[model samples]
Target: MGSTYRLQLRNQAKPTDPKHQPYRFESVLKVLNNGDEKLKSWKVFVGFRNDEYLVSASNAVLADGTSLPANVGNGTVFAGYPMTDLKTAIETAGDLNQIQVQVKLLGTQFGVKPPNVPLPETIQLANDVHLS
Candidate 1:
């Protein structure tokens, strides 16, 4: 795949719970620079609806450093730590796996049902580098 993604709804024997909603889901977003030389201090925005509760995230951190259980229904932006810039295949010697970031997000909602997807409404990625 050009870009990697993971979207799944927990289908437990009893997937319904009262903590927030009966529907629980997780999404993985991998953003990269497929057409650029490199992206400096890159950040990615993932949009959603219904004001879902963000249980947790891994491999990346929110720009605001919001702790777990944050609200992400409106949308959220995050960036990879330690290695913030995304190098292109050339930079990594054709190692595509080393040129991107993978983020895992867990959340919950109540209104989304079958026939509808439980994924981000929109995803935008950009670099924060500024030219002097």
Candidate 2:
């Protein structure tokens, strides 16, 4: 048994036809649990789900028991719009060692239905929220 945290990504945006590019996002985290410290981040390949991407500081299992890689992508780039905000938050955190993450698109809404549960209405609203 060890420490575990949740990561979520939501597409809070309406589909804009043309001109507006398709949206994509990622959650980058610096985690510290007990006495161990590490930096871990995950990028959404298909960034439209409003689901939790669970992470563990020790051995943890996905709901389906799928294996996830330890390090997925390089995180050196830190500038411009969305990434700017994400970078600032990561840098300013007083406790980057132990953290949880919930990431969402800036102007969309989403919901989740667990296994065997009835799916709820799709969320559709624009909000200005800081994940801090």
Candidate 3:
């Protein structure tokens, strides 16, 4: 069995006060088991970046749901950051479209065996997200 994963920017909390410089946002990461075999556990590494530098990076895990045998299931993880930093990064790079997100799946599942099996590797969720 194999799995599919995705990452996205969600749950945006903009500052109510215009004077507030830093806006806050969250990254929603999801993993979906698409094959017949049930997943034992999974982990992913995510990085948020702009053209010039990385804004934030995090590792997420799914151990509870994957403990049982099941098919066609999904898991989620969230990462958050301040908009002021992100905006500054983008501005310094001179392009709003330079914002991007990257994700990589760690090949070791908790209960899965056999080293020869292939595992999902990497995915890019967004090259540019329109921040309003």
lDDT of each: 0.69, 0.25, 0.27
Q: How large an RMSD does model 1 have?
A: 4.0
Winner by lDDT between candidate 2 and candidate 1: 1
**Clashing residue pairs in candidate 1 (N, C-alpha, C atoms within 3 angstroms):** none
- By lDDT rank, best first, the candidates go 1, 3, 2
**Residue 29 CA displacement from its true place in model 1, Å:** 0.4
Best by TM-score: 1
Model 2 per-residue lDDT tens digits across residues 7-126: 333332346534432322233322122222322332222122333222321322222234433221211111111221122224546343233223321222223222222121222111
> What TM-scores do the predictions have?
0.78, 0.19, 0.25
Report the Cα lDDT for residue 80, model 3: 21
- Score candidate 1 by lDDT: 0.69
**Clash tally for model 3:** 1
Clashing pairs in 3: 23-83
Winning candidate number (lDDT):
1
Give residue 90's error in model 3 in angstroms: 44
